[model samples]
Target: MDDGQPLFRWSWVVSNWDNDSPNSIVNLLQAHIVMSAVPVIVGLLVSLPLGLLCVRWRWLYQPVSGLMNAVYALPSLALFMILLAVTGAEPVTVIIPLTFYAMAVLIPAVVDGLASVPEHVRQSAVAMGFTPLRRLVQVELPIAVPVVLAGMRVVAVSSISLVSVGALIGQGGLGNFFTDAYQRDFYTPAIAGIVLIVLLALVADGALVLLQRLLTPWMRARRSA
Candidate 1:
């Protein structure tokens, strides 16, 4: 403990809460939320079109998947340093790398979700005289919701946790706690950060589950039958 304080103290968290400073608990948490959320939203949006293309043209899947895998393999810290030079924006430095990471997860999720549709499901849509676009919107995608939500749950939790890594460059949000713990030799902030992060991940995952339920009511109906 720094200054003879205990290893973990709620007082440290309480005193720092929303103190209106850069390092305050509330500020770091809010920064953490934005830093985490923007990438997932952007990644999902980009993956939808890309995944649809990959599914539509079978040959495209290999090249696209390979590229995403390569991108995924790149170290997050290394990318942070590299992107730092390319832009003057501080948050972008973190957001850009995290966006790519989310895509690496979400693209495959989108593809797998689409692929999960049964062959009979497709035939039924066609038999109903559904156009390609209408079929995708009304028939195929609704059925694919569960699988896609599963992937989203994974991405959301991981993304929330990963935001802490951004602290190395000073954009880490709650991740700054780890660095602070190291520098000050105080464990309180670091412990609090971890607890808060887990809670945030749980909340995000639960929200996704609720969304999945709302989107796929028939899943329950099928289970009962």
Candidate 2:
């Protein structure tokens, strides 16, 4: 048995894969996915309406947008700490800060997307008896979908990476693997976690690219036609 301890052992991780403990790698992954998705979905819901409002009201463009820009500039860890203090290490603590992070990234993209809508197209929509809401819903939003999706892609990638910070507060994820590995000097699992996070980011990015292509086929057809 090699002195009753494994030399070059893979079983430490492999054997524990089916464990039901909160700290299990599978549990970590589930927690990470759940935590990250909460913020991205909530942020999108909150930001989309505000984004639409900003486009409709010129006054909101400066103050509200500027405030979100300020939030974006705050470091992720700092925001996390602030939320932790307020919410006391609960899941809501992490979710709230992450939502802010998502919003910070998303709101600007939404603004840019709306602003990028061609002036002529907007005018045409108005002349075609389209109400402002109808014009925004039908013309502006469809054209802006690519940019909005791009923002979501950015947030998804950032959230995956930022989740590592959540490990500091006893949260689970590949981040926990990272922290445990660092503490116990286990190099392989640490490297594995890093690789997994990177791969997740790449996969999310690729999926968003495919989605954009699928959603904007008219843009492709026009270029070819």
Candidate 1 Cα errors over 4 Å, as ranges: 2-4
Model 1 sits at a Cα RMSD from the real structure of: 1.5
Report lDDT (CA) for all predictions. 0.88, 0.81
TM-score of each: 0.95, 0.89
The candidate maximizing TM-score is 1
* Error of model 1, residue 96, in angstroms: 1.2
List model 2 lDDT by residue over 148-216, tens digit each: 998999899888888878888766377888788778866656766777788877887898889899989
Candidate 2 positional error at 200, Å? 1.6
Pairs of residues clashing in candidate 1? 166-172, 167-172
